[model samples]
Target: MKKIFVYGSLMSGLDTDGNMNGAKLVHADCRTLHKYAMYIYEDYPFIFEGRSNYQIKGELYEVPADVLKHLDAYEGDFYFRKLAEIECGEETVSAFVYFGRGHFFGMKEVKGGDYRAFRGKDGN
Candidate 1:
């Protein structure tokens, strides 16, 4: 199993029936990774290229290898998942990050907040 950091709709009980709705949460006290900007495109969430000192809130989940395939499919061509060092609790853990292919470049930055928190599912 591999640990994944989720900061958007994949969070527990918010959408897709919470973390266990599609994936399993392995750590309870996971640390949030900061210094990055989150953006929303259509209904999907993506991180933008930027610099920040604040941490974005999220959780660490243990995903089965098979489940990763499904997640990859859901992300589609708009995003490419890359291995990244994310803060989990007190230690740093390697997790998959979804990189957007410059789809939302025209939109303004969300400042110091989660992108999903601002935009709706329709990307409005």
Candidate 2:
């Protein structure tokens, strides 16, 4: 299994039937990192972009490689999977971070709204 960090739809039960699908929820934590901004791309949930001081709240999940591949596909064109360090409880761990692409070129600020407080089956 591979360890990964999820901040957007994946963490909010928007995808994967609200059970984290098949991924194992290791834990949740507040993580801040350099050079990253969050945005709701095309209004289809939020995705990270650019490099900034923005700290995104997220959950750490231990998932199979296959499942990770599925997530990569789900993130689609505007994201590239990159390894990142996230604070998990008393320790900091390395996980995957999705960086925005193409259409998201030149974005530098965090957008309005957030997925961390989102609810409902529709992921809105």
Candidate 3:
């Protein structure tokens, strides 16, 4: 199994979360050790390195090899998968994170790291 950090739709309790079927939850409400930029691409959220602003808030999961392979295909070629450190509770651990690549265009950056809150799912 591989540890994967998800900050967008694959997060638990969100649309496309079913893509994580068969994966075990490692942690919830976790943040990245390093900061990154997050923006809304269409209706979905995507993040990239540089211009660090916020430590992304998301979840961690232990996914099987098959599932990880599936995720790679699911994420397509635009999102690059890489290992990164994240704050899971009080411990920092390394996990596979997908960094999205695309044109910024008219994308709006999210102030807070939480995508749910940005989407108004948390009623914030």
Candidate 4:
């Protein structure tokens, strides 16, 4: 099993969660160890490496090799996966996070770095 951080669709209760059908949820209250830029495009969200005001909120999951392989292809070339530090409870661990490549011109910035809240989920 490998650790992965999912902030957008792949997170539970989201549209793309189906892609991670075989993954196990590890932590739900996970946050990026550092601040990063987050944006949304047609309801899809992507995170990018950069300094930002808020740490990206996400979830941690443990997935098998086959699931990881499927996620790589599901993310496509527009997004690249990289190891990033994540805060899970009082512990900090490295997990694979999908980041956007190149310019995301028209994408709207996600304030508070939460895709779920931004989309009006959870009554936020």
Q: Pick the candidate with the highest lDDT.
A: 4
Off by over 4 Å in 4: none
CA-only RMSD, every prediction: 4.5, 4.0, 1.9, 1.7
Greater TM-score among 2 and 3 belongs to: 3
Candidate 1 collision pairs = 13-18, 31-89, 34-55
lDDT of 4 by residue, 1-124 (tens): 9999999988888877899899999999999999998888887788888657689998999999999999999999989999999999999999999999866669888999999888777522
Q: Kindly report the root-mean-square deviation of model 4 from the true structure over all alpha carbons.
A: 1.7
Task: Report the lDDT of model 3 for residue 73.
Answer: 97
- lDDT (C-alpha, whole model) for all candidates: 0.62, 0.65, 0.89, 0.90
Looking at model 4, the pairs that clash are: none
Clashes of each: 3, 3, 0, 0
**Cα lDDT tens digits for candidate 1, 1-119:** 87777666666645542324557776644544546666665556666445563456566788888777777776688777777677765788888766667756555555555544564
lDDT of 4 at 64: 99
- Candidate 2 accuracy as TM-score: 0.73
How would you order the candidates by TM-score, starting with the best?
Answer: 4, 3, 2, 1
Task: Rank all candidate structures by their lDDT, best first, as comma-separated numbers.
Answer: 4, 3, 2, 1
lDDT score for candidate 3 against the true structure: 0.89
In the range 10-48, model 2's lDDT, one tens digit per residue, is 764555435457888888654645445566544444455
TM-score of each: 0.73, 0.73, 0.94, 0.94
lDDT of 1: 0.62
